[model samples]
Target: MAHTTDETLTVLVYSDDRNTREQVRTALGRRPAADLPELDYLECATTPAVLRALEKGGVDLCVLDGEAVPVGGLGLGRQLKDEIYGCPPVLVLIGRPQDSWLAAWSRADAAISRPVDPVALAEAAATLLRSRTAGRAPATR
Candidate 1:
């Protein structure tokens, strides 16, 4: 992904579990690898909140939990892709690695299995940000 000095990519993380969201935030804060730059994250606990936030502000990437209540990340990801134009790239967290194909079906750009590895989460987020900067439309409409 091509990046500029002034660019601060925004990531929206959606999960029903507060602790899971915290883990993602902490990992992102660390900026594990030297290759990927630091970014800002907007956390959302519910689907409606996610929509409202996107309407109020723009985002570069989204990290969604497949197990979230009401609407799982994969389902939400697909809905966003279909309903929104130029949705940001999505990074989904499936319950297991076996569901990778399901993630693909949802049109998620990338996915990782839970429990998440800190380094993997950071890498995935960076990759999504890079993809966003590279002209890929975001998954949110």
Candidate 2:
């Protein structure tokens, strides 16, 4: 898949908290890296919304909040990896650095601790996006 400059990649941001979703969108801005196409975010505050968006397809990446209530990203990420065919790369936000092992268990492509450092989030997101666009398999554990 060749992406042109005009193409905008779709990124799915899943969190029950509106603030978390906003933080991710703001941190990422219009584009995470200059080499990648601009991003179009599909924000989902509920699990059903997330499922619908993903099932409908065209999501290039997933950013899930580990602290989200009802269902955390770690469990959700694991489910997506297990269930969704050709699931896009997942970046999970963990509560602490120590939870990186949980991220590995979830099978996320990448993980970052929350308080959502803009720089780290951007770097991780850009890396996953690059892999997605480049037709490379997303890294596992």
Candidate 3:
């Protein structure tokens, strides 16, 4: 899909830890790839906030923290997948590479292990965003 330069994609970042959210935003920057549209981020520090933001719509992608307290992103991701009429692609932040299977169980579109590798995070996010721009249907569980 060809995106206009003026177009900006909205990415929702959900993490209870402030640092995790900041890291994601910093890693993604203004745009993950030159071809994709610029990014606008919406940070949610709580599960309720994440749900509320998603309900309002307009989110192109989601970066969720799997290690978050009370309700983890993996569970939340699953909830979004099952509940949301058309949930946006979700990129889950896992604690280790081996936890990728858990990410799959959560129905996340992509998974990245923290301490946030800027290159990998950007690439994963960019790919999901591009898929969104291409109007690809969300993957089924």
What's each prediction's TM-score?
0.85, 0.92, 0.92
Clash count (model 3, backbone only): 0
lDDT of 3 at 28: 97
lDDT ranking, high to low: 2, 3, 1
lDDT tens digits, residues 45-74, model 3?
A: 899999899888889999999999989999
User: Per model, how many backbone clashes are there?
Assistant: 7, 0, 0
Distance (Å) between predicted and true CA of 44, model 2?
A: 0.3
**Candidate 1 similarity to native, TM-score:** 0.85
Predictions in order: lDDT: 0.81, 0.90, 0.90
What digit string (tens of lDDT, one per residue) describes model 1 on residues 63-109?
A: 99999998999999998888778788888999999999989999999
Residue pair clashes in candidate 1: 84-141, 87-138, 87-139, 87-140, 88-138, 88-139, 88-140
Better of 1 and 2 by TM-score: 2
Give the residue spans of candidate 2 off by over 4 A.
1-5, 135-141
Write down the lDDT that model 2 would get: 0.90
